[model samples]
Target chain A: MEIYLLILLIFMIIGSIIAIEAKSLLSSVISVGVVGFSLSIAFLMLGAPDIAITQVVVEVLILVILIRATITMDNTAIEGGGGTFPFVVSLVFFGLFLVFSFFAVQEIPKFGEPLMRVSERYLRTSAEETGATNVVTGILLDFRGYDTVGEATVLFTAIVGAFGILRRRGRKKKTEEDAEKVGILEDEDIKKDFEGF
Target chain B: MPDIDEEIRDTSKGMTSIVKTVVRFALGIIVIFGAYIVLYGHLTPGGGFAGGVILACGYIVLTLAFGRQIALRKMNNKAASILDTSGVLAFLAIGLLGYTGGYFFLNFLGRGKMFDLVSAGTIPLCNIAIGLKVTASLFAIFLALSIFGRFISSLVDEDE
Candidate 1:
C-alpha cells in the first residue's frame, strides 16, 4: 500500500510539472486533471472515500469550465515558453517547500497512531449522541455545524460576486453601445432609463 | 452557399447523434445514482456535496450533448438562482429549529432506529438541503462562467 501511494505521489508530481510546463492551454488543463485524479486516488488509499468522491467531481467541473473558457480563444496565443526568472524562482520555492515538508512529516504521528484528543472523543461518543453511523458526517453536521454554515455562506458570497461582476460587465457593454447611438431617440430613451435607475 | 451555412451551424452546436444518444442514456443513470448518494449519505461514503456535484455533471452532460441553449432553457438562470436561495434558506431554517432544543443545529427530530432509511433525523434533512444548494450553486456557476466566455468570444468575433 505504501509503495502504491509513493508511486501515485510521484505520478502526481510529474503531472503537475507537465501541466505547468505544457504550452497549449488544453493540454495543460488535461494534465492538471491527471494530477487531480492521482490525488483523488491517494485520498482513497488513505481511507477517505468521501473526500475522494468530492475531489473527482470537483476536478471534472474544473476541467469542464477550463475547456469552455479556452474553447474560443486562439490556441497559438496560449502557447508561451517558460522564462528563466520564473524557472529560478519556482526552483527556489520548490527547495524551500521540500525542506519544510520534510520537517513537517517528522512532526506527524506515526502511522496507525491515534494522535488528537478531539478525534478520540468524537469516535467514542459520536454514534451514541448523533445517531449517525458515519462519524465524519456526524462531526461535520452536528459537532461542527456552525463551521459548515460558514462554509455555505462563503459559497453563497462567491456566487453572488461572480453574478454581480458578470452582470455589471454585460450592462456596461449595452450602455456603451447605446452611447454610440447617441443621436437616436431610442438610444436617448435607453440612456434616460439607465440614468433614472 | 445556404446548404454550407446550415451545415456549419449544425456542426458548431453539438457532437454527432451517437454521442448525443449515449449521453442521453447515461444522464438518467448518473442522476439516479447521485440522488441515491444524497439520500443514503448518512450511511454511505458519499454525501451531499459529492451527490450535488454529480447532479451538476448531469446538466453539464446535457449542455455538451444538446447545446447550451436547450440546457439553459430547461433550467434557466432565474430558476437556478431561486433554487439556490431556497436550498440555503431551508438549511438555515432547519438549523434554527434546533434552537428550540436549547442549541443551534441540534438534532431535534426523532432519530429513528439505527441503519434504517429514516434514521438519523436531522442529518438526512440537512443532507437533502445541502444537496439541493450545491447542485443549484454549481450549475449556476457553470452557467455564468460559460455565458461570460461566450460573451467575450462573441465580442471578439464582432471586432473581427
Candidate 2:
C-alpha cells in the first residue's frame, strides 16, 4: 500500500512537472496520458479492474485523437506557453484536495464490505437473471442499459463532430474543383484559394 | 478498379518488394483476427468496442501497407456510412422492441435455451450492432483524416 502510494505520488509529480515544463504540445499531451494511465492503475489497486480497463481504453482513444490533432495543427504558436497559470492553480487545488482526502479517507467506509455483501446476495443470480457471466457487463448492459445508450450517443456525437471538422475543408475543395472545371472560377483564383487550404 | 491514385512506388526495387510482401501478409492476418473477434464477441471475453477497435487497427495496417485508395475501394464512403447508420438503426429498433415487450431495452427476444452460445437473447445482436457502428465510424473518421491530411499538405507545398 505504501509502495502504491509512493508510485502514485511519483507519477503525480512527474505528470505535473511535465504538464508545466514540456516544450512541445505533443509532450504535454503524452504527460496527461501518463497521468491518466497511472490513475487507471490506482483504480485497479482499489479493486475496480473493470473501471480501470474502460478508463484506460477511453484515455487511449482520446490521447490518440489529441496527439493527432496537435501534430497536425500549429501548436507551438501559442504565445505564453500552454496555459501554465491555470495549470499551477489547478495543481495547488488538487494538492490541497489530496491532503484533505487523506484525512477523510479514514472515515469513509471502503468497498470491501459492501462488495462482499452485494456479491454474496447477487452474484449468482445476476447471471441467471441477465444471462451474462460478467456481473459488470450485466449491470452495464442490462440493469443500466439506458445509461449505456446515453454513453453510446455521446460517442456518436464525438465521431460526428470529428467527421464534420475533417470533412468541411474537403468539401470546400471539391466545390472549388467543380467551379474551376465549369469555368465559374479562374485557375489563379482557385489556386490561391486552394493554397489557403 | 478506377484510375485511383498514381502508384507512388517504383516496382523495380527488390527491397521494396520484400517489404511490401511482408506488410501485406501482416495486414491480412490482422484483418482476419479482427473479423474473428467481431464475430465471436459475445461468446468470448471480447466485445463489440474492443473488436471494432481491433478491426480499425487492421484497416489502418492495410492502409499503410497498400494505400488509402485501395482500402477505400473495398470500404467505400457510401457503404461505410450505410453500415454506420444501419447499426444505429438496429440498436434503436431493439430498444423499441423492448419497449413494446413491456420493458425498455430489455432482452425479450429469446430464440432458444438459455446458456447456449447463441442464446443470449438480445446481447449478441447488440454486440454485432455496436461492432458494426464502431468500425464504420472509426473508418469514416480515418478516411476523412487521410483525405484531408493529404489535401492540407498539398496546400502547404503549393504556397512554397
User: Which candidate ranks first by TM-score, i.e. highest?
Assistant: 1
Separately for all candidates shown, the number of backbone clashes (residues 3 or more apart, or on different chains) is 0, 0
Worst 10 residues of 2 chain B by lDDT: B151-160
What is the two-chain DockQ of model 2? Answer: 0.28
i-RMSD per candidate, Å: 1.8, 3.5
Give the range of the ten consecutive residues with the poorest summed lDDT in model 1 chain A: A167-176
Each predicted complex: what DockQ?
Answer: 0.51, 0.28
Candidate 1 per-residue C-alpha lDDT over A45-155 given as tens digits, one digit per residue, 9 for 90 to 100: 999998999999999988887776766666534545779998899899999999999999999899768687898899899888888787778888888888888888898
Model 1 achieves a DockQ score of 0.51
Clashing pairs in 1: none
Residue ranges of candidate 1 with Cα displaced over 4 Å: A76-82, A100-105, A111-114, A168-197, B1-13, B151-160
Model 1 Cα shift for residue B46 (angstroms): 1.1
Using lDDT, give the best candidate's number: 1
Off by over 4 Å in 2: A1-9, A36-122, A169-197, B1-22, B35-44, B111-115, B149-160
TM-score of 2: 0.70
Alpha-carbon error at A193 in model 2, in Å? 12
